[model samples]
Target: MSKTVGVIGGGQLARMMIPAATNLGLTLRVLAEKEGEPAALAVTALGSHLDVEDVLRFAEGVDVVTFDHEHVPQAVLRELVARGVNVQPSPDALQFAQDKLLMRERLAELGVPVPDWARVVSSEQLARFLADHGGRAVLKTARGGYDGKGVRVVRDASDADDWFAAADGEALLVEELVEFRRELAQLVARRPSGELALWPVVESVQRDGVCAEVIAPAPHAAGKVADVAADIATTVAEALGVTGVLAVELFETTDDRLLVNELAMRPHNTGHWSIDGSTTSQFEQHLRAVLDLPLGATGCRDEWSVMVNVLGGPATGAVTDRYDLAFADQPTVKFHFYDKAPRPGRKIGHVTAGGDDLDLTVFSARAAAAFFDN
Candidate 1:
């Protein structure tokens, strides 16, 4: 019987998984909150990812269950596991991805390097933290944060009042803002049978709290930095007992220290360039990891590949009509459009350009993204 893979969220990440699933002769199903969600355009099933009944029904016949996002409740995952559903990145391991504070604590316990942080629940606590950390720090909610949401930079006590009120006086984390030279991401995949694969580290550029572009194999990254990143990613995956793809976002501090920034247990935006640039795309590697299939080579197809996100602009309604013009002039630029309705700052789609020259590839990607700008 052909294997059936059930994905929990219907977004671009899941949408991209379709081609890989088809190539492997595996059936793909998606549990989405609404129709027209990215993966819903191609997935076999459409339902609410958060509804237990919907998820249970969707998983009835699947060989294994994975996810496009970590928003699913741990209780729901545990229940599914209780009923014999094979869920990759099991609930126990997924918790670290779901809650940043938990991930920080766990990583620290494992002797992983990370920025200094503390949990603060009150204005007084925030004040004390600020006093110790040069009166400037970053406050992040323990849950429900992404794309720069649920994060704040506060330099004074009054700035934390709203957070304390909104969280019902619950604890929040305040971390010292380190001066980082640049951000880098390390992608790794772990199989159920204990196999692991790490891809080349990529440099990520962020603008206004959103990822603007990704440059593969990080241009000036020392050989030792790449080796360290891969080792750290592998160690985290093994320590977390994760199955499927895991991405470790890092901070390259000004002093050359690498500090862990975030952990993602599914396909990440940072790895988007792999689709057109690597022999094995992250989507395919994720499927293979979840299915415990032998992993594939992660060799680069070109010396450089750059991915640029097309953030929604005022003329978003014209995206469909503009696709023709967008690609008509640049056939070498690969465009992956999510079937999502555009909203300001939303990730509508992305463009990837691959070539031997890094600067040329980045320029091509930027031009493609600019074509869609209103």
Candidate 2:
């Protein structure tokens, strides 16, 4: 019998999973947030992921439950597990991703390399942390922050007064502002049965705190750096008891050291290039991992692959309207659209280009992605 996999959120991640599930002959069901959300077309049911009754109905008959996003409430997830549903990356491991303070505390216990950080419950506490960290620090809500939201760089306590006021006396997290040479991402997929697969460590380019591009097998990542990255990712996966794809976002310092910046237990934006540039896409590997199937090879298809996100631009128009131009200009570039309306800075699509030369591949992808900007 074909096993059914239920995804708890309807976003681009779930949308991308449709093709992989179809190819694997698996049934893919999504508990979409809205009637016509990005992954709605691929869903078997429609409802908010937060609704216990609705989620219970969606999980009925599904062999395993996964996620498109990590925002699902812990109460709802725990309820599902209590009901005997198979939830990969169980709530115990997921709480770290859901709450940064918990993540830092756990990583610290494991002796993981992380930046200086502290938990702050008041403006005075934040001021003390900032004083210890060069008088400037990054403050983040322990829960519910992404894409530059709920994060701020503050030079003094007054800078974060609003965040403190909004927290209703709840504690927030503060960390030293990292002075890194560049950002790196390591993606690892692990199965319930202890099988693991790893992809090359890649360089991620961020603009205004949002990832704009990724270069597979990061430039100049040769011996020790690559090995340490892989080791860190592997260790993190085993330590956290994470199943499915786990993305470890790291900061590669100028002095040649690595620091754990963040963690995402899902097919991440950094691995999006694997769709056409790897022997196996992260989406496919994620499914195989959750289902406890033998993993696929993680080799790159070309010497270099560059993925540039096609963020919504100033001019408003459908992504398809620029496809003809993009294809005609760069036939080798591969485009993946998420059936979303264009909005400034939103990720509506992406273009991946691979070849023997990194510069040319990057140029190709950027050109194709830029065509949509107008």
Candidate 3:
């Protein structure tokens, strides 16, 4: 009998995992709220991640349970665990990924470098945080923030009232804006058997608070920098007792120090390039880690590979037509669409291009993205 894997959430990440699970000879089942939610359309089941009965029923006979997102409530996860269902990146480890405040505190306690931050529950607390951090800071909700949502840049104390109102006047986090040279990401995979592997560092470009592009083996990054970042990621994964893929988003300060920005316990946008650019993609590694299978190689298959996100724009109706025209001109580019309805600023798909020359690869990726726009 083949082993079954139960995945929570039904986004592009889950959609991508389907191919990996199939290749591994594992059955993929998803708990989703509705139809057409990326993976739900492709997986073996459709259920609500929040529905205890639905999730419990969905996990029946599955060898292990994993996730595409960390939005599921801990109580629900704990309930599933109580019933003998195996949950990778267990609830204790996932809490840090789910809550920014909890992640910050844990990293601090582990002596990991992170931005100066304060947790604020009221206007008075916000005011004090501003005074201590030079009247400007980034405010984030403790939980449920992603892709530029639930995050804000506040320069005045008055902004606290709006933040509090936005979050229903609940507690929030205020963090100092560090002067950084560039953003970097380190991805690591940890198995239940205590094995781990690290991938090459990648440079991530953010536009309008959304990831725009990723360049693997980040240009001009020193060998030492990559080693340090990987070591830090490994340390954090072990310290937090995380099982499965863990992505550490880093801010390289002007003074050449790396500070943790965010933690993701799933296949991250930063590692998307590995799909066609590495010996083993992050999606495959994630599945292996969750299943406790031996991890594959993490080495890059080429000197340079670039991945560009295809954010939906005004010309929505022309996407299919654009894909036809774009691929006609650039047959080497690999495209993966999410089978999603297009919405402005939504991530509908991504393109990856690889070449011996970094400049050419980036140029090809950018041009392919532009071709889709036209």
Task: Point to the candidate with the largest lDDT.
Answer: 2
Model 2: residues >4 Å from true position, as ranges? Answer: none
* Weakest 10 consecutive residues of candidate 3 by summed lDDT: 313-322
- Give lDDT per model, in order: 0.90, 0.91, 0.89
Clashing pairs for model 1 are none
Question: lDDT per residue, candidate 3, 121-154, as tens digits?
Answer: 8888878888898888899999999989888888
Give the TM-score of each candidate. 0.97, 0.98, 0.97
Residue 341 of model 2 has an lDDT of 84
lDDT of 2 by residue, 23-141 (tens): 99998999897877788777888888889999999999998999998998999999999999999988988998999999999999998899999999898998899889899999999
* Backbone clashes under 3 angstroms, per model: 0, 0, 0
Candidate 3: pairs in clash: none
lDDT value, candidate 3, whole model: 0.89
Residue 162 accuracy (lDDT) in model 1: 82
lDDT of 2 at 115: 90
In candidate 1 the C-alpha lDDT for residue 80 amounts to 93
Q: Which stretches of candidate 1 lie over 4 Å from their true place?
A: 313-317
Best-to-worst order by TM-score is 2, 1, 3
Between candidates 2 and 3, the lDDT winner: 2
Pick the winner on TM-score between candidates 2 and 3: 2
